[model samples]
Structure formats: C-alpha cells, structure tokens
Target: MPKAIYAIWWDPNLGPFLGRSYPENDPLTSEEAVVIFMGHGLQQEAKVGYTKLAKGLVVSYLDSPNCIAVLLDENDDPSVVERNLLRLVGRINFNSSKWDAEITRAFLLLQELIAETSGQELLSNPHVTRLVEDMATGRVSALVPRHVLRATAKYPKASDYLGPDEEEVSRLLKDLERAGHLVPKTYGRRVECRQCGGTEVTLELACPSCGSNDIYKVYLVFCPKCGNRTQTVLVDDLTEVRCQQCKQPAKVSELSVIDVELLCKGCGQATNDPKIVLSCANCGKHMTNTDLLGGTGLAYYPA
Candidate 1:
C-alpha cells in the first residue's frame, strides 16, 4: 500500500505557504502542532502515494479512505491543482458561507476520484458506494479531529497514499479543518478558533476564472453554462495576464484583457483577481473587502 502522512496549519491567510508553517520554519514539527482543529483558516487535503508498480492500482480508493487529510500535497503543480480545485468548486460552489459536509464530501470524492483511470465507471464499486453512504449517513469526515484516536486499529494501516507512523490519520483531519475545507463537528463539544477564540472567519471568494469579485459590475462574457470565462484565467501560468475577450472561443494564449468580472469559489461572488476580492465565510460568495465596509463600520476601499 502507498504510505501517507498528514499535517495541518491554521491561520487567517492560507494563500501564503501551503504546507510550511507560516512565520516559522519549514517542515513543521508535530510538537508545535495544535491539539484541536478549527473551523477557520485554509484547509489542505493531500494524499501522496505510489502503487509499487507491481500492485497494478488495486481497489478504487477504499471505502471512506478513513479520516484522511483534508488538504494534501505541495508540489509545484499549481496549474493542475488550481484548475482541478476551481473546477470542482465551480460545480458545487453557490457563492455563500463556508462549505458544509455535503460540499466537503463532494470535493473529497472528487479529489480522490479524479486521479483514477476510469472515474465515472468506478462509481459502481462497493468502496465508492460505501463512501457515498457514509456521507449520507452523516458519519463523513473531511478533516480529522485534533484529538483523534489512531485509525490504525480499525484500518490497521495507512491507506495506499501515506506512509508509516509519520503523522496519525487524526492529524490529517486537523489539517483539513484548518485549511477551511472541512467542517469539524464532534459530540459533546464545540469547535472554536485556535487564534482569537472567534469562530467567525472571512474567506475571499472570486471568479475561479478571472480570480475577481466584481461580479455585479463586469459584463460576464461567458455563457455561464461552461468554463469559457474560466479558461481565460489560466491563459498564461508563466506570467502576468490580461483577459481574452475574444468575440468567439479562442486559445487562452490568444485572449486579451477586456472588461469583465470573474467568480471565485472561496466566496460565491464574481470577482477578478487583479482587483480586490474578499471571501465571506458568512455567505460563500465573492465580494470586495469594501462590501463588508458598507454596513455602519470601518469603511475601506477596494485595493
């Protein structure tokens, strides 16, 4: 089986370093790891594995994959990761509060399934069926709890992804929870913030394509049914970019910046990244930081 190890980091801004602990050193130590998971911060669900080449890719991801890490991997494959993450988000994101269990489960399934050789065909497997059942039964977990009991006793070992006694399955769950991907709900206790004791959080939501939050203002050029506008965002991963307001469908390289607003999955609001985009955990839509300033409070401007 492919060995897997998980880790989590919590902070207001997760966009900085994915795996590395912010304001600290690289390769975080387990001792400094928090004892609990928070409902805020960035959540990363990573599962790294190699099939040993002889195993021939046995089984389609395992029933629930147990309490696997919510966020995983920090390879330089930002392009692929970003595209997949946004694609998944585009399908489910409604531009409102943080993702719920249903949303988390959907993405969890998506991440696990996307890598498979035959995804749609593999859905019929018993393991996939059980995962769906777990999600429906409300026993699903996108992130492991902070005080997690080792799943080794039950599963007897890490799934095909992670390796040995590296990081307990529980720790992976905590990382996901911290990454703002999974919702942590346990019995007889409440999940609170690890930082300021404030459970409330604000995540920037923007156009997954344009990475912008000016939804209401820009003239949405795409049909809104497909990922046309979205393809524009990834036009050039190598450098700064301009929108490709092509009168017709064209290559991302052929596109040029014009007037339009993009949408973000972090927040459900339409926004362009070049401008100000804010994520609102309250409602999973994209908005300007100024959007929050509208209601009798500290007024600020869009940067």
Candidate 2:
C-alpha cells in the first residue's frame, strides 16, 4: 500500500513543484521525483510506471502537463501501485470540483483493491490491469464520455480498429461502481449513427427534397397597396420590408403576416416543417433522425 499520493504539475522554468500532496509528512518527495523523472531526457519513455526511490518505490505517471507520484511500501507490487495511481488521476481529472475530497477516497479504494483478504495482489490478473488502464487513459477525446457499461469501445478515428477486451473494461467499471469505487453521472442522452456508432452526429432540419442544410426562416407578407402576396425580405436595418413582386416597400410592422415557414436555399421549397436529418460527421453518412441509436449516456469518477 502506498502511504501518500501527490498530484504535481511540472513546469520547464519552475522545475516540478506545484499541486497538492496527501499525508504531508511522508518520507518521499513527489515534486523532486517528478523533476528527476522529467530530467531523464527520454522523450519516448513510458509515461506511466514505477521506479525506485530513496526510501521506497515511487509509482509516477505523466498526465500531460502534470505528473502524479505515489510512494509505495517496499512489499507492495509496483504495477498495482502504478495502476491505482492512474485510476486516482482519472477520478481527480474527471470530477475536478470534488477532487479535494476524492483524493482520500481514491487512495483508500486503491489500498483495498491492491490486497484482498487472502493477501493476494489483484494486479496478477492482466484483465484487471488493462481494465484500470483503459478507465484512466483510453483512446477517447476529452469531450467524449466512455459509457461504463458499453459492450465495445468506440474508435471514431480508426474505422476498422476494434478495441481489445472492451467487454472486460465495461464489466470492470460496473463492478467498481457496485463496490462503491465509482460514481456515475449522466449528462442526458445522445443519438449516434447506427452504422458507425459515431456520436458526432448533427441534428439538422433541411429540405427533404434537396437534402440541403441551407434552410432559412421565411416570412410571407401581403402588401395591401399592390395586393402582392410574395416572400417578404427584410432589408436595410430590418426596418424596411419589401415584396419580391412589384417592388412594393413597407414598414415591417405595416405588412400583414400571411405565413411563416422555412425556405430552402437550394431548391426554393417552402414548408412549415423541415425534414429532420441526422448527419454523421465521422463517416459523412446522411440518414433520417430515426436511424440514430438513442441511449442514456454516462460518465464516471472515482468515489
């Protein structure tokens, strides 16, 4: 078990010395460890791993511009400590508002998960380690939230690359939630493309006949002077409304509103209701809104 966890931010000029440390009087110095790790001059070094420290092993990971180091006991498994650190960082980053309180809970969960009642390290199971690693830093964009109970991991970038052990990851996250190690938060539902399961779908109302997104709100007005029933176009500071026919001009308020509808810029079709189209940004597939898969989406943070 690790005694303390430190979330340190590394700066090129300021050396590596910002962020909060847990259990302040620990024997290890996480900031100095981060400085030493960065100074190693290996751009290709593995971002997450464990290394020997002065008193004990330090599990350190580079979280982009910041670093998190955990000081572990001599008898502790280094890989387990590293995995736990990643998981903690995942939680901290996911729910930044409650991070101060979550730091203690994460370390406690890590200690519990590291050793079972029989004193066996769970890190021996490759499935467990992989699941934890994926939960922390999977190939997901920051804006996208990976569903905790999803069957397979989605790869929006690579069309053909299937994720490895995705079911296991999903199962592991659910189990963690049940064990009070994960807090799930829902941010409403999203419709995804049925073919590629891409969530980057745009819900647009377009011309059904032409399939054009260039639809504009149009107001048809009746010009009393010329008796012209034509499309009313607002011009010159929006105070002047002109009829398409007869070039009759009147104040916007003076014209009687006959109909308000969406006019398509492509085929010039005017209708009260526009066609709901779902466009997949990833694959450029156009389909009806019904073709999308709707599900309750969620995100999770360590409890």
Candidate 3:
C-alpha cells in the first residue's frame, strides 16, 4: 500500500470538488488543485487510466457514475497504485450511485483501504484478490450484477484462480451469502454426479421402499375393518374409491386418508414417502438428496 499525500472526489458534471492534503496543510483553496488535475485527467477521455506525475510522483484515477476520484501518493509503482484504485472502484460500485450521501461513504472506504491494516489482509484472500485484479484488468464490469459471479466462474482459468474445486467455490459463495455480500435467488434443485461432479444428473421420483421409478400420484385410503392402508381405485364413474388391498369401499375422509404415498409398480408395496433420487448420466450412480450439492442462483458484489 502507498501513503496517499492527497485525495480528491469530483462531480464531473458540476465542477465542484472535495479534497484533502494529508500530514501537512496546503495553502491552496480546499479543492483548487484537485479540480485542476481532475479536469486534466478528463481531457484524456479515458474512463479510468493513470498518467505520470512529475518525477517520482504518482496519481491514481477512478471513474464512477458522473463522478471521478484521483489520488496522489508518493509511490511510483503503477501496478500497486492501480490495484488500490481498482479496489476503491469495487467499493463505490457495490454501494450503487455515487452522488448524494454515498460520496462521503465512498471516500471513507477509499481511505480505509489505503490506510487500514485489515485492508492489506483482505487482499490475501484468493477470491478478493482475483476480483480486484479482474476489475483492474477490465475483465469484469464495474457494476457487478448478482449473476455475473457464477458466470465468471465458468470462464476458463477462473476456477483455478478462485477455488481448488467447484464444490469449494460453491462453499465460498455460501459463505459470502451468509455475510450479506450476495443477493440470493431461488433455482430448481440441481444434482451433480457424486463420482465425477458432472451436472448431467436426472431427477426422478422413485419408490421409497422398492426404489422403483414407475410410480404415479394417487390418493391413499385407509380401511377400518381390515386395518389396511392402500392406494384408491376409482370406481362408480370416479364418484367412489375402493381399497386396492381389501377391495372394499374406502370412503374419502380425513380419517380414511392415512397417508398419500408412492406405490411401487414392481413390488406392489405402498410407502407414504418417495425418494427424490438423482441418476447421474455419466457415472451411472444413484444419488439421494444428501449426496447432492445444492447451489443457489445469486449475484455477488463486494461489501
């Protein structure tokens, strides 16, 4: 990290500025120099690109919605300055619009990242490191929509830099979700192959007892005289139902409907529950719910 000698926040549309000189007070009006340099930067027409200051002097550039930030530091390593600049950009983008009260928050974030000790530690995490680098490299958009993270992970070389495996990537996402850094969305339950981690697993409703896939939805009717519970057979123009086991009238009542379950066509055994099983297309292994990895559809941004 570099020691910032001066920092400026400018609204390009309004030409007003906020800036400070650190360690020693400069005699210039609060933002006179800041606005001049910011205008000089705009003449270049690049959204975010840095230029050389006089010998040994360094400056960083960041552009947000209708606003621009410039930092003056003593450090000359362009890579280090750009990394810090990109990290600041990430924070501004995450907080949304940069106008209004958010301007103060944005600058505070920038100062914290450059000055705080934890900010250095955060750069050690692989995910954070990659995200900051991606922002700096223009590989990702400045405003991070929620779904982009997952889509980015599918890109080549992303998984290697982000996680040891896809499962661990999913786990890291879950942790981000817990920390409120992610916006969550619902998705249909998808199962991956336990053996190969392939996503071509087909979900099927199977019998809980006999593990048969040939089952249809039916109402279970209970019998009083025989104490038996079984699937109901439609009779009398579908006006009445009879017990499959005892062939007796199984009246439709709350008490008579013991348990609605799946009936295995192969074994004729009635079970009140069915297994929501996954069959891996690649590995040929049947996976139960517990064996599957669950993923959430989400959008992620730094918080």
What TM-score do all the candidates reach, one by one? 0.17, 0.37, 0.30
Model 3: per-residue Cα lDDT over 1-303, one tens digit each:
343333444555764455433332332343454443554344433334443433234444534323333445454345444444555655554344434445455556656654431335545676757855664566653332222312222322335456555544543444444434443455434454445444555668888877788875566666765777776643244545666677776445433665566667888876766787667654557866644646433434444
Residue 6, model 2, lDDT = 67
Q: After superposition, how far is residue 165 of candidate 1 from its true place, in Å?
A: 37
Off by over 4 Å in 3: 5-16, 19-44, 51-58, 62-73, 92-155, 163-303
| Order of the predicted models by lDDT, top scorer first | 2, 3, 1
Model 1 / residue 187 / CA error / Å: 43
Task: Estimate, for each residue in 139-197, the C-alpha lDDT of model 1 and write its tens digit.
Answer: 55332222211112111122222333323333332233333333544322222223222
State residue 169's C-alpha deviation in candidate 3, in Å. Answer: 14
lDDT of 2 by residue, 1-303 (tens): 677776666566665664666675663455466544653334413456456666666677675566667778777756556545555565555336665565566667667655531122443455444444454565332212443212233322222222344433433444455545456676445455565544565567888789788878788888866887888645456877666787767778788888878888899998888888667654557755454436555555545
Better of 1 and 2 by TM-score: 2
Q: For candidate 2, give the lDDT of residue 29.
A: 59
Candidate 2: 10-residue stretch with minimal lDDT: 153-162
lDDT of all predictions, in order shown? 0.33, 0.58, 0.49
Model 2 alpha-carbon miss at residue 176, Å: 16
